[model samples]
Target: MASGFCEDCSRLLDEFCVYLRKVCREFEQKIRDVFRELSQCTCFRIAPESSFLRRRRRRRTQELLSLHLLCDDETQLLNQESLHALSRLASSEDTDLQTTAAMFYLHVSHHLKSSLPDAFMEPVMALLLSTDLDVQKTISLSLVNLLAKNNVCKELVIEMGMLVPILELFQSGDAAAQCHSCACVTLLASSESKSEAIMVDGIMPLLALAKSYEPQVQQNATWALLHLTQSDWSTRILCEVGAIPVLVLLLQSSDSQVQFYSCTALCNIAAVREHHPKLLSMGGHFLLKSLLTLVSSSVQKNSTQACRCLQTLSRNVLIQEQLMELDCLVPLKALLKNSSPVRRESAITLLSALSAHPPNNDVLVSEGLLEEIGQLLHHQTSVIITHSCKIITDLCGSSMGQQAVMDSLCVSGLLGALLSPSVSDETSLHVTSCLYHLVTWDPLKSNLSVTITSEQVSRLVRLSGLIQNPQLSYNSAAIISTLAMTEEMAQLLRPHYITMLEYLLVFLKKKDVKLQQLGILTVFNLKKDGGFSSLLAGSELEAQLWKVHAQTEETRRLLQMITPLSPSPVDP
Candidate 1:
């Protein structure tokens, strides 16, 4: 079969590989011309056979002989002896030896990175500049492999001014040459060092290549921009260069990776707050749809990136409405149900931010967001629990949202988190804040204990817990103070009376006006129970009552309620 002929070509290449490697050893001057001409490479050509490019659906492949000859096992890397010999041959007026040596280096060039020759890029540039189209195509592809993850070589190539020629080849060459050229540029673009070269070389060429008819070139160019836009400054620069429109179009590409790279690049561009308005004006609605579609991507990083991009966009208040109109909460809830920790956390934060808009709240609650959060509040990771609690806190800010949430299972999950020993300080802050929102709601005030148990109240009033973290202390004081507004909820703290006295005394001496008022109100509530009145009466603030000048009318009114109720102090 004609197809089997390619497999047999490896058998024919053994003689060529052996003869070529042996020539480097003996310094045989007589047969050098014969071997050089035998390696003349007439079997295939990488340059287009014609000027037409759009019909070239696939990247052209090299001949079987070269692929067989240049394989990993067939090519021996150069030592100083052969390196000098190849150097002399490489510099010859004959283009065949330059092409021959460059072909062998498809396997050999990787060795240059081992310890790195002093002028390693010199021959790379030399071979790349050969008038022979064969040499340019071979070395360009080889340069792709050589420069990969090797910043030192990348810098050497850039400092040698190799990019302009590579960019030229990328811009003007045939399919094979452009593929290699774009690849080399893609590898070189991975670090911060290329900014200066890119400044001079400019990204317009890459933007042009992103729309290349060839998928590989298009895919690579788009991917390179993903790396280029790693920094906010570069992203801003890319947007200023009109990258947003190009990225927007690539989102419609048939290639999945192209779509992915374009999505992340836009994520970077969208991260700049100033660029938000531009992204909106350009095609913000279409952009949101593209991102929302990717949010359900099967690839973990794909969805992670999409979620991240959405989170950044959600920060803009206008985009929040767009998101709600798009029913964005549906996939976000799915992500919360099952996804990576990173994706889940991002989804949580985005949902929390969206909950800030009053209208988005009802949409979220109806979309099973409350049910998802109910499960997340009991997740294994405290960070998940923390983020979930934040959504509850944000949603609980509104009367309609508060009523809807209290009717769901989210409240019990929150109460369970409050009693869980593993909860972090941050989780405690948000979770306690949610509890405050619920207990203080007027409709819920008639039956506050049904929503928050007395045991949870006692935990909030614990002296060590109250003074432990400032935010927790504030929320705890707020929750306990709100409860102290009614005697039924105040008696929830009766067993922990001494703990409440110590907690109240701690806050009563603080400077925060809200904390001062909450502390004074709780002190007034505790005094209503006569048995413990003496212990709180001999308190430091009571002793300094007249000396304490109230900051607000509310604080002064609450302070006057507890002024000198009794002279005697009770036993601890």
Candidate 2:
């Protein structure tokens, strides 16, 4: 039996390639007739000998399929061949081929849409509207991918009014169709500006679907919201349609992924300046309180959303005050003390935004929050310290905050942080800036005794000790200059002036022009208390000053041409 079946299969294989490559109308009809006959017999349950022939027949069919694809010259011809194959499988009284043909239609239709004329789109759109839910969802999924590739097809799809079918798919009782609908919307939402149209198309009707009991469908819906809510208009639309309530409902989902993105979606929508008030109107504060709970619970995802939500909350002064009223500061301040550096940075950020309000600063100060910020001045990362310094400056801008910060016992820690050797040059700048703000405070001057010690003074002097590191020297000079303006600070730093002078003079010995120039500036500043003459008293310092003054003048002359041309003399 096997031998006989093999011979018959060999005879059938001989014309397989020719049949597949045939282009004339009769050739296609013959191939369809052969496919119909082959689809009838169940070859799998036959005897082993006959099954061998069936396997050979299957191989020949696949080869013929491959040949048809290769022989087609243009995309339209290929699409027609695909349509023929689909027709055979769709109409033939064979289940397997029907399945195979459905899949074949999908594969070929995808390719044809790219290279074929715009005319082929109607067929693909027709597939999306099929009564067969599986077929509709599958092909609709593919159409979205094709249309999203370019604005031309995207516009065509829109003009074709096919989005309504896709939107209907979103509402389908079939979970598979619903998932594809969400996917389709995401593809359509790739353009940021057009997102508003998706909202106007009744997207809020699907919010409940996003919060559905089925996890897979809900995930897709949430993702769709993520993309749609990227636009401010969609956020407004969602809020107008009360989508926030559904989103907030999803926040309590047992699935962390759902809850995570749901909160993120909320944050994104809430971030819009216009929509922020709407969020507050729609219980935005409750959402924020939920975020605060997440932060306190050590759920990292929740903490991140909470931080961003706090930043969004910064846009509303009323909410900002409300945050204080809810005592939102406690968890955020707790984050500052957190072991995670990121959480601490977030805490600092919220505090900075919260402190921007004058009333909130009092709350922060009254709560002893200045010390928390002061501790951050010496953080391992310069960025944290930089922000911490800005916070310090803001806090010190108010008299109450200044007094609270000054009394925090971290003042010396802050000053020592400036002199700390391992921090980045940027950090040194921030530290000096904080000191600048601290000393420049009009009210703090009277209370500013020599709270900074001789040791801290010595540390500041050594900052300029390394002649090769000029940024350090500049920062130290800045710190000293600020201190010098205060009589008490100057008195404490006076004993160390000669050491600073020696460092500056040695720095001048180098051929660096800026160093030479700064040497003069240091001398000029030190002259405020006649300290220059004191350092120059040995005649050695005097000789060095004269040498630097000349070298400085020569360097200035060399740079004169590179300087901007002077404005033409005014006609007097």
Candidate 3:
């Protein structure tokens, strides 16, 4: 009996091969008639079908189907007959046939791409809603392909009401189906217009999927959440729905890709300042460690994003301390030298935040952060230069940082930066503050006067006169006061004495004690020359001098020297 069955199967296979040859010959009607007759032939579907017979029948059907569907030379382009057969079989009740048709459509649709008709969406959607897991997975993959092919299919998928059912599969389907479903939703959510609808129908399911034990589901869902959170409202919504802890937990995921998306989503959520505390409460320490790890690795894009996320989270002072304690400076310092300008800038920004606290300043200085910042000062980008200068200024706030700046000879860079015409007002202000700290370092004071030239002094006088920034103006006044202790600088500054006096008088009139003291000291330096004092004695500018508070006795004596001894004995 087995031998008889084998013979019958051989005969059926021979007939199918002959049919395939005729179909390939462009005899469209004849091929259709052969397929119709073959579908009804008893030999093809014999009684008491065994698994082997079923496999043979399906394979032969697929072979015959390929003739009408694919071109003879290329498998991608579908002939009209193959597309019609696919459309029909896609909705077939036979589970295996529908599965085969969906798989074939997935392969060919990639090639035909946008050329696939709008009507093709209906059968795919029908099969997508099928209860069979295999059929659903196959159709879900095909829909993802279609949606990715072009915007028209994407819109058609949404128009044909496929989004909700696919999202529904996230709950009922197995891991593979859930992954594909989340992937499709991820694709749809990428469209700005489609994002709102998917969020309405799918955000909760996606958030739930984000917590799945399966990594792919978590990856796809988090990726989808990443897109949805691009809008401010959606970001707030996600945070309110408590996506923060879940995303934070995903940062510990063993998969780097999962860690990446989770980090990015948390980064977006943390863009709003209010979310910072929430993220910290949800084990943000692990997030910091994960990001620092990514930065240490060689993946440039992920490292850049991780740096950005760290930059935002580091804004909180407590977090900054934690980052410092965790030795985040190592990775951040490495990123400072990164080839990517953005990552370098982000590293600089995070370092700037970390440097805000005095103890962190010591950590940064120990890490050679000043040299990195000095290198950044020469960067062609203005913002990098600006932030680099600001970080130096912050570091210089601590005494150890001051010695480090002076010892590193970053002072020359700071001076050059201060003199650069392209420097922003903020950058100029920071450079001036850095200079102020350097000159006040006592041990570095004389070195500064020696290293800075008379020409640079003249530039400082001009900068003090023209710039409108109060801090720059005040620090510039303080630097001149410190630098003019040398007679050479005093003489070089003599040429601009009137302008310097006018600028000083503005600060001398302020309620700020520091500015008043700097103003008095600068005037005292200029008064060293009997010639300048005599000049001060003669000019009408001395009237502004009377308003000086004489806060200290040195100020009092300096006032006495610059003030004409009360025209005592106007020897009339």
* Per-prediction TM-score to the true structure, in the order listed: 0.63, 0.66, 0.57
| Model 3 agreement with the true structure over 430-477: per-residue lDDT tens digits | 677767766777766776887787667777787687536777777777
Worst 10 residues of 3 by lDDT: 67-76
Instruction: Please state the error at residue 140 of candidate 2 in Å.
Output: 5.1
Q: Candidate 2: misplaced stretches above 4 Å? A: 1-117, 126-141, 158-181, 191-202, 283-285, 376-379, 412-424, 441-476, 484-572
Task: Indicate the residue-level lDDT of 50 in model 2.
Answer: 77
* lDDT of each residue in 183-266, candidate 1, tens digit only: 776566554564563543657788888999888778877877887677554566677788888998887788889988998888
lDDT for each residue of candidate 2 in 409-446, tens digit (9 for 90 to 100): 44665676765667776677677667656766654543
Question: What are the root-mean-square deviations of the candidates from the true structure over C-alphas?
Answer: 13.2, 12.0, 13.9
Better of 1 and 3 by TM-score: 1
Model 3 accuracy (lDDT, Cα): 0.72
Lowest lDDT sum, 10 consecutive residues, model 2, at 93-102
Quantify all predictions' global Cα lDDT against the true fold.
0.70, 0.67, 0.72
Shift in Å, residue 419, candidate 2: 6.8
